[model samples]
Target chain A: MTSQTKAEQTGAAGWTRRRFIITLGAASAAAAGLTALPGGAAWSAEDAKTVEEEIKRLMGGKELADGAKIISMDLPQIAENGNTVPLEVSVESPMTEADHVTTVHIVADGNPRPGVASFHFSPLSGRAQASTRMRLAKTQNVIAIAEMSDGKAYMTKAEVKVTIGGCGG
Target chain B: MAKPKPRIRAPKKASKGEVIEIKTLISHPMESGQRKDRKTGEIIPRKIINAFTCTYNGQEVFKADFHPAISANPYMSFFVKVKESGEFEFTWVDDDGTTYSKKSKLTVN
Candidate 1:
């Protein structure tokens, strides 16, 4: 078995802004070797508008403050069954009475019931870790929202391929 | 059929400094409300395990809040860092006001 390099484990996201600057400085010392690679920034030229519209419909068309770097979503790279797929979400924030995960919402673009579920949390909740299996009618991207106690909204997503039907099968 | 009693697996005892592993599974129909029963020809209202919580030695180690997106017969595996040996109690509650509970013991070295 091969151990994953630390860089690989972090994915394209593992690099924070401060880390990027440090890496850039190191690359500058090596004669143009440190060029910044393209990042998965959440900038939308077109599709972003559509996603925003969908979000407004779901949230009463209120402007949603963007959330970055606070929420993480995990799922199987490939689901064995389209019917029942497992999903887990975690947010790196203290569940303090003053600052905790307020709510978590999971949505999918392809499912019949797109708004899969919404969980309301409070500071009494020692932590924000959710694990559950879902029914995916087909292959689609699953999205998760973590609303922190501080009124900040963070979003993360995963792509899953549903293999077999779970609800009817 | 009435819901079966929740099945919990445990050693009934554990010890200190050793991280204790716990597994929990609850028998739930986890109806998504989108499916129709073949025999009754009626819409199944959403009845799922909405959340799960674990308390060790009276302190909560983990908690999860769920949505309709979660599948049926929810099964979750997680661990708690054991500093002292005590009974770990787990409870899973459904939206229908049903509660399933199990307790395990641990001994500290």
Candidate 2:
């Protein structure tokens, strides 16, 4: 939270620039490591473009803004096996019929298909948290978007590096 | 047809209006169609659990739509509010149109 505020204080000079550089550096390093394995090049080349396209498709062409405060995604920085990447998603909501999360979408940019899963919820759920095991083809950002009942969307993303490809090798 | 084993874990009892955790696991290969046979080199047909749903006391609690990216023997955990004594109906739909289901009873005090 403090760092995010500091980033905001920089007004796109310090925070966004630093975050962008860090993300780019990490992505390149991870991509290099992934491409070293058999059939890794094909997976490493999948950039954030696919993830954006997927979010667009899932949103039905709806627009999305940064949801740093509303959604939280839990994933490992490095996955020993790509076949069973554990994921957990949680959203801030009251779980009341008046204002509750309606759906949560999961997407992996490097997978053969961008759409990984979508979870629906209601007031009966009591909370908007979901955990499951997912297969990852390579190093990529796994995105989670939560749709609220009042026609609003929030999202968060995490990157997972796969040592061994999960889908096929 | 052989039955697919679906298992669930939840509190046998809970206080009314208390939030509790629910866990589910189903035994499945969850074969994604992207693989090839080691010998014949033919594309393996995809067979995965595509959806999962849970209902409590006849009221829908939570639901999820999965894809080939889901691992074999898919396992998931979520939360629910227990209002009354009833059962949780857990269901999983596979790519082959197979619906595997199981139920667990809960007592709310």
Candidate 3:
């Protein structure tokens, strides 16, 4: 109205620009939210304890005795890859019906789920041993618990240091 | 759909009452459902081998339950006590309801 053509033209275009900026901001915010979810939840120390507690509860809340010699866990001291780590567990026992290893529970305390896998054995198995590859979310303890037919439980723990790719921050 | 190929390495011969080892590996990507597509930025649905079982002479010898944290090309090894000549069957169940299986024969002398 006062011969201010340039200012008036800019004011009209500024509204559209503001809306565009707002839309872009919202889109980025949504992407951020998605990234914050699911896999982003790192395995924290508290989570490790929770995993141990859950395993204990599954074991009837009874503490597992340290199996210094009976149980052997074969895993690398330093895992170069966090995604694929080979593990082996062997229990020295006579595969007899009277005295045999019943089950072995594998737990990676640092993974999202503590209990990785469980191996069951019968006298027909002749040996209590298993090998498998698993993903480790982070640096944590890998535990193996072997339950015998005589109602005795033994456990061993090994720490694996995960060295490569994790949540790409 | 192209089926997954399962491979097994087990000795064909063993002494009677001998403990033998069996190894198995399957071809699978094992998408953890926790990943996102790099280009589309979309979450990839989780798919994995959820379970594995081995039976000898129609009797269960070994079994395992797997989570998403298992490796891509899932590999497992277990021991078995061979009693006589029998067939060993290995089975793997995927998350998508696909079952991949293979068989091997063992002759215990």
Candidate 4:
């Protein structure tokens, strides 16, 4: 009985060691492919841009005014699914040639990438309103920034609790 | 993969200078390049619709730039003011330099 138990224990240990080696080999192979593949460079480059960097790239150092009165966002307080979270943004603006919302940018703080979408509007867009669905990696804040034709920007943010992460899938 | 299909919804008739809502959806995987293949454990390269535009009678009305964070099968809704009966052209540009477009006519009364 003692011999049999020892043999079983050794078999289990050997199985674990084999799994560890296989995992290490796979990880190294993936790392090598990430650098050696043709499109891999671009993929890593895109992954390097953080949320703050992306936001700066969009805003270009412009002052963001408080949008509490002008901008309104409709988003779920708790998203059951992070893969598809509904988002709606609207700005109080009279769609006119002289004064209108030129662009509305959506950015998620906890997404793999910050930028969600940027909507460009014109006077023909009678209302400064838009709705779309986005993916959230985790529980994070969703920010909406509206750039007006008059060269001013309005910004607002809301937090959304996510039950499951969307990026891993 | 099947060809990405474009779908749009807009009112067929509207009063002059009336505001109307338009919704558009396109079928695309929007592969974020972050997910790994279950069997191969290999990362899937990203391929998504990057830009969408709506033009009324040749004048650009609404445009959007999309990133990977956009869900698969992108859907967008916006507003437009109709001044006259004309065709609204909706275009979706993919990351692979392919453009898919659809047109819808609106009659202004």
Task: lDDT for model 2, please.
Answer: 0.80
Q: Where does model 4 exceed 4 Å of error? A: A1-41, A44-48
Model 1 lDDT, residue A151, Cα: 64
Residue runs of model 1 more than 4 Å from their true location after superposition: A1-70, A92-105, A115-130, A148-151, B9-21, B59-61, B79-83
Residue pairs clashing in model 3 are B33-B46
Between candidates 2 and 3, name the one with more favorable lDDT: 2
Between prediction 1 and prediction 3, the one with superior lDDT is: 3
Local error of candidate 2 at residue A115 (angstroms)? 1.3
Model 2 misplacement above 4 A? A1-49, B1-3
Error of 1 at A149 (Å): 5.2
Model 2, A51-112: lDDT tens per residue? 66767777877767677788988899999999899999999999998999999999988886
Q: Per-residue error at A148 for model 3, in Å?
A: 1.5
Candidate 4 recovers a fraction of native contacts equal to 0.80
- For model 4, which pairs clash? none
Q: Identify the leading candidate in terms of lDDT.
A: 4
Tens digits of per-residue lDDT, candidate 1, A1-169, equal 4565576656877555332333433333234221121231222222222334545554555344544477777788788776678776667766666877777777876654455656555453444655566776667788877776666676667788766544442
Chain B TM-score against the true chain B, candidate 4: 0.97
lDDT of 2 by residue, B30-100 (tens): 87766655444344566778899999888889999887788889999999988889999999998778798
Q: Could you give the DockQ of candidate 4?
A: 0.42
True contacts kept of each: 0.29, 0.71, 0.66, 0.80
Residue A93's C-alpha lDDT in candidate 3?
Answer: 98
TM-score comparison, 2 vs 4, better candidate: 4
